[model samples]
Target: MGYFLLSRLLSAAVVVLGVACLVFLLIHFIPGDPVEVILGEGARPADREALRQALGLDRPLLVQLSQFLQGLAQLDLGTSLYSQRPVMELLAERLPATVELALAALLVAILIAFPLGVLAAVRRGTIWDRAASAFALLGVSVPNFWLGPMLILIFSIGLGWFPVSGRAGLSSLVLPALTLGSALAAILSRMVRAALLEVLGEDYIRTAKAKGLSARRVIWWHGLRNALLPLITVLGLQLGALLGGAVITEVVFSWPGIGQLTIESIQRRDYPVVQGCVLLISLTYVAVNTLTDLIYGWADPRVRLGIGE
Candidate 1:
């Protein structure tokens, strides 16, 4: 366990470093001088030179890249060109909102997917199974951008049940969470149903059923736990992806989360904020992937022994 954990953490560190460097270069190499973007056409030549010198834009590209990397070692993402505030500070303020929305979406996915998956597996060819598949298709086929507004219209405007936008409270979070979770739930249900169907065909399931155990008991107690291995991996990885996906939903609804801030900063070409936000997101994805791999190894003994043993 110790060795595995160490290896995973090391991999995560390398991935984070590579992603940060890539993002830095992407923003750095963008066309049009950043100084021109910062200062309009009316600015004097002397002022432009002074601004370039002050921002260290006068330095060679390699030197600027080196300084940026060194600053990153200490968690300093530099200051935004537009806001003149530390990028890390802005990220700290915005991150919690994204985390909250992602959590809510995960909860929604679990609640909707698990039962439907189970029923589809148990019922097999019945109408209930068909219905589950249909719902899953809708979840996968429809894009969130389109679904988000429709949810708002149906729940907020049509039924007058929830708020259309804003992050004022729980009511406002409902539509956005539902919108984000539905797509995820659809994909997850298909996986769960497939996993469960396979597990049910195994010898242990037949033995349990032959012993006169109730169908629900056999499925929940025996089949479910064994089948959960693949589903667990999907849950771990998809939950991380959902964090990234929430940015769009958050923006559509005017939620003040990291995604919204990241978009706003990008539009203004605020280097510090853009770099900081992208770094945070990339680090999160790598860390979560590493964690999921480690968890899978721990949960399945076959994976821990390196296969040959």
Candidate 2:
């Protein structure tokens, strides 16, 4: 286990380094001058030159890249060009909201998907299975950008059950969470149904039923436990995706999370903040995938042996 963990951590570090270099180059190469954006077009050339020099934008690209990489080595994300605030501090402030939204969304997805999936698998070709399949189809078909507004219209404007936007309290979290979770639930439900159906056909499941165990025990204990291996994988991957996908939902709802911050920084050409946000998101993706690999070892001992290799 220790060896597996070390290997995963080392791989995660490499992925993060690659993401950092890629994001830095991409942001720099994009056709926009942060200095000019900060100082209006009508500003004097002297003012622009001074501002550019102050921000070190006047330096050669290689020099700037070297400095940025050095700052990263020292755990310094640098200051934002527009706000003059430390990029790390800004990210620290915004990260919790994004996390909260993602976790809440995950919880919603599991609650809706799990039972529906199990029931569909148990019922097989019944009406319940068909209905669950249809629901999954609808959930996947509706994109978050459109679903977010529709949710706001129905729940916030029409029903007034929740706030239209902003993260004030639990009530305010509902619509955004729903919008994000709906698609995840759809995907997970299908995975769960497939996994459970396969597990139910195994010899152990039949043995449990023949042993005169109650139907619930045979299904839940013998069936769902084995079926969870694939479900766990899906959950880990989906959680990582939720963080990335939150950007669109956050924008539609004005949620003040890292996703929203990324958009704002891009508009201002705040290179430090944009890089910081992308870097943080990339690290999160790598971290989650590493954790998922660890969970694989826990779920199946055979997987642990594979990891050691």
Candidate 3:
């Protein structure tokens, strides 16, 4: 167990380092001048030069990279080009909103997907199964970019059920969460149905049924529990995607989260903030996958033994 955890942690660290390097290089190589964006095109050359020097943008690329990495080693994310605030402070302020949005979206997906998936699997060829399958297809087919606006138009503009945008209260979260979770729910429902169907055919499941356990007990306790292994894999992977997807949802709904911050920073050519945001997101993805691996060991003793070896 210790060996497995250590190896996973080491791999995660390497992935994060690679992500940081790639994000830094790509953001710098992008055709934009932070100084120009900050001072505007009409600014005097001398003023631009002074600002560039002050921000250390005048330094060589390698020097800047080294400095950035050094700061990272010390747990410092550097200062934002535009706000002049520490990147860590900015992340601290914005991370909660993104976390809230991600968790809410996951909850919505699970609540909708699990039951529908189980029902679809159990009913197989019934009309209810067909309807559930259709719902999954629609969810997967509709992109969040389109879904978000349509939702705003119907629920907020026409029906006046929820606020159009911004985060004021729980009411504000409803639209964004729905928009973000809909596709995930769709994908997850299909996975659930498939995994449950497979588990239902296993020898142990037949034994449980033959032992006179009620159908519901056999399906829920025996079937669903075994089915969870695959479901967990899907959920873990999708949770990472949810964070990346939040960027688009945040923009559409004007949510004050890390995604929104990242977009704003990119527009301003704020390197530190953008780097910080990407690094944080990458770290989160790695962390979630690692946790998923640990859960795999916990869910199946065979997996635990394999890890221990």
Candidate 4:
């Protein structure tokens, strides 16, 4: 267990470091200068030069990279080029909305996916299974860009059941959450159905039936638990996908989250904020994968034991 944990931690650290450096370098290399964006084209050359010097854009790329990494070591994310606010502070302000949306979406996925998946797996070729399969296909087929606006048009504009945009309250969150979660739910439902179906055919399932455990108990307790490994794996990986989708979903709904912030930063050529957002997203992805590995060890003892041995 110790070894497994240590290895995962080390790998996570390496990944985070690589992502931070890569994002910084890539942002710097991108066309259009932050200084140019901050200072208008009509600005005097002397003024632009002074502003560039003040922002440290005049410094060598290696020096800037060094400073950025050093600041990261102390959890400082630097100041936003456009806002002149601490990157960390800006992220702190917006993080909650993104987290709320992501969690809500995850909940929506799990709630909708699990039961439907189990039912589909159990019923196999029945109409219930077909219906679930059809829903999954539809969910996967729809992209967030289209789904988000269509949802807003129908539910918010047409029916007036929900707010059109912004993070006002629960009602406001519903549309974006559904838009972000639908694809995940679709993918997960299929995964769950397949995993459970495979587990159901195992020898132990037949033994559990022979032992006269109630059908629900045998399926939910034994079959589902065994099926969870793959399901959890998908959930962890899909979390990153959720974050990526949040970018589009938040934009469509005008949600005040880091996803929107990232887009805005990019358009404004705010390198610090953009770098911070990407780094934050990358760190989150690594952390979730690590947590998933830990869950794997807990859910299946063989995982940890095998690593330890």
Evaluate candidate 4 by giving its C-alpha RMSD to the native, one decimal: 1.8
Give Cα-based local distance difference scores for all models: 0.87, 0.93, 0.94, 0.92
In order of TM-score, best first, we have 2, 3, 4, 1
Q: Which ten residues in a row have the lowest lDDT in candidate 4?
A: 300-309
lDDT (0-100) at residue 171 of candidate 2?
Answer: 97
* Cα-based RMSD of candidate 1: 1.9
**Which prediction has the highest lDDT against the true structure?**
3
* Model 4 / residue 267 / CA error / Å: 1.2
lDDT of 1 by residue, 96-162 (tens): 8899899999999999998999999989999999999999999999988899999888888899999
Ranking by lDDT: 3, 2, 4, 1
Give the winner by TM-score: 2
C-alpha root-mean-square deviation, each candidate: 1.9, 1.5, 1.8, 1.8
Steric clashes per prediction: 0, 0, 0, 0
TM-score of each: 0.94, 0.96, 0.96, 0.95
- Determine which window of 10 residues in candidate 2 has minimal summed lDDT: 300-309
Model 2 lDDT, residue 4, Cα? 72
State the weakest 10-residue window (summed lDDT) of model 3. 300-309
Candidate 3 lDDT over 1-309, as tens digits, reads 777677778888898889889989998998999999999999999999999999999999999999999999999999999989999999999999999999999999999999999999999999989999999999999999999999999999999999999999999999999999999999999999999999999999999988999999999999999889888989999999899999999999999999999999999999999999989988888889988988886777777577456
lDDT of 2 by residue, 1-309 (tens): 778778888999888888999999999998988888998889999999999989989999889889998999999999999999999999999999999999999999999999999999999999999999999999999999999999999999999999999999999999999999999999999999999999999998989988999999998898998889888788988999999999999999999999999999999999999999999888888888889989988778878678455
Please estimate how well model 4 matches the true structure, expressed as its whole-model Cα lDDT: 0.92
